[model samples]
Target: MSHTVVIKDIRNVTHDVKRIRLEKPSGYSFTPGQATEVAVDRDGWRDEKRPFTFTSLESDSVLEFIIKIYPDHDGVTEQIGQLTEGDSLIIGDPWGTIEYKEEGVFLAGGAGVTPFIAILRDLHNKGEIGNNQLIFSNKTEEDIILKNEFESILGSQFINVITREEPAGDHVFLDGEIGKDFLKSQINDFGQAFYVCGPDAFNESIMDALKELGADPEALVFEE
Candidate 1:
């Protein structure tokens, strides 16, 4: 089933990311970390659906999505970036494999952090964010989404890895990609649940490193 919802508000989260809020249909509900297919309500674009994770909690009055736009791709996300308030989007049923199993380390790369937004928010709201950690990697400091919010929610547990431009402050900077050596050095316990979300290459690399470190395969949660 699909619902046509009007955009209630739209704002920029970063240079290329947008935080969009839409009217929530009655009875609409979804778990944290879940996503839904969304299509522009415009004529020819109605069928060009893209999966976007819900950044809003299930109890929120409006549905929200934190989307990263690539204008160079000239794809759905680019069109989404141009959409303004009052625009309508066709949202499909909620579905996703990434969900919170327990307090653990969350590995996210770039835009992949979208799914974890709601999960962390839910935990923070319930005062159950105990010992949860977030290891977010981005090209630069400017590319990180909700940096302040994550820091507030997770405190010193929020880790940032920058691979491109040099970060300004005392943030951890990585010249190369996240590999076994880095993961092993940063994470001590390999027995906890590992929620990983990122580009294909990032996911594969992290999963392989975690498995090699003796992390239980079943405890590694990610979208398959």
Candidate 2:
């Protein structure tokens, strides 16, 4: 089922990323890390569906999405960037993406962290955030979404790795990529649930590293 939702609010989280809140349909529900296909409810873009993770909790009165827009692509996200409070969107039924099975380390790159946002929030609300950690990598500090929120929730368990630009902390990742050495140094145990979401290359590399570190294949969860 598809719901025609009106945009209630839209605010920039970064230069290219926007946090959009939409009206939630009555009885709508979704798991913490699920996503839905969204389409601009405009004449020329109504059929162009793009999958976006839900950043808002299931109990929230409104649905939210943290989207990164690439203006040069001229795609659905670009169109979404142009939308405002009064605009409407066509969102599909809830679909599973990164289902959180248990507490463990989360490896995320860039906007891939969106799916984990709600998951972590859910855990925090339920007092299950302990034993869960987030290792997020971004090109620069400006690209880190909800930095303060994540840090507040995870405390010392949240690790931020800035690859391209100088970071505010000493924990910058100067190597430009996360590999076996880095994983070994940061992650002490590999037997827990491992959630990874990022570009194809990042996902592949991280999966390989986790596998090499003896992480259980069945415990690895990622977006399909």
Candidate 3:
């Protein structure tokens, strides 16, 4: 069933991204990395549902979503950019294709990092972020979301890649793609779990690269 929730707060993460806090329904609950259909509560818009990952931990009293809005397109996300506090949203029950099964390397592109946020935070809270690594790619440094939080949680293990800019030290990349050579140099064990998410093309390319690198296909978790 779908629940109608009022927006508790709205804030900007970047020029084109927003972080929204919504009221949690009485019986609502969801695990990290899960998502569901969401639509504006206004008339004629309630059916235009889009899937968004939960950026908030389950223990929190409110629900949160980190959304990347594109003002150039007159789509749902464009409308989302115009929303404000106290606006209502229709959210469906939680469902997910990505879940944390083990600690390993996480590869995310742009807003794809949303799902991994809660997963890592949950682990961090429990002091179980053991040997986990995150390789996040963005168009620029400004596009990286929750940068400080990721740095604090993963420390030196958090690696950021700026594709549109020059690479430096650990935040490096060649051709804007995390290919076999880069993977080999950063990750030591191919047997560990690999979590990946991004656009369809990004997902396919990364998964292909991982498979070619001898990473077990069964251990690679991603949005399907």
Candidate 4:
């Protein structure tokens, strides 16, 4: 099913990222880590559709999406950057396989953190965030999305890996590859579920590393 939603607000979270708030349709419900496909102006785009993860808490009546506007990309992201408040978009039913479990580690890169943002927010609000850890990576410190929010919810449980920034505190922001040693140092258990999201290469690398670290293949969840 599809619903027509009005753009209620827009805020810039980074140079290339925007947090878009939509007026939710009546009787809509979604899980924390679900996603929806959006279509702006029926004929305004070539593909006319794009998938975006929900960044707002599930309890909120409205829907929020954190979208990364890629100027060089050929598709909805570029078109989405041109939208303003008062515009209307077509949104599909929420769907995704990334469900929040009681104990796990969330590994995200760049815009991939959007889905987990909602999950963490919900868990924090319910005082259930203590059971999970988050490892978020980006090229630079400025590229991290919802930095303050993540820090507040995750506290010492959050690990930020900025590949291009100098090492800060006890965390080392390094380049090259992320290996089992790095994962072991940050995560408490390889027996717990591992949720990874990112670009193709990043996801693949992390999945491989988790396997090498003795993570069960059945306990890993990722976008298909």
- State candidate 2's TM-score: 0.98
Error of 3 at 151 (Å): 0.1
Query: What's the lDDT for all of these models?
Result: 0.93, 0.93, 0.90, 0.85
Off by over 4 Å in 4: 167-171
Candidate 3, residue 130: the lDDT equals: 94
Residue 81 CA displacement from its true place in model 2, Å: 0.5
Q: In candidate 4, residue 6 scores what lDDT? A: 90
Deviating ranges (above 4 Å) for candidate 1: none
Provide the global lDDT of candidate 1 against the true structure: 0.93
Superposition TM-score, candidate 3 onto the true structure: 0.96
Write candidate 3's Cα lDDT for 77-107 as tens digits.
9888889999999999999769999989999
State each candidate's clash count. 0, 0, 0, 0
lDDT-better candidate, 2 vs 3? 2
State, as a TM-score between 0 and 1, how close model 4 is to the true structure: 0.94
RMSD of 3: 1.4
Error of 4 at 219 (Å): 1.1
Which lDDT value does model 3 have at 3? Answer: 93
Q: Estimate each model's TM-score.
A: 0.98, 0.98, 0.96, 0.94
State how far residue 218 of model 1 sits from its true place (Å).
0.6
Pairing residues by index, what is the TM-score of model 1? 0.98
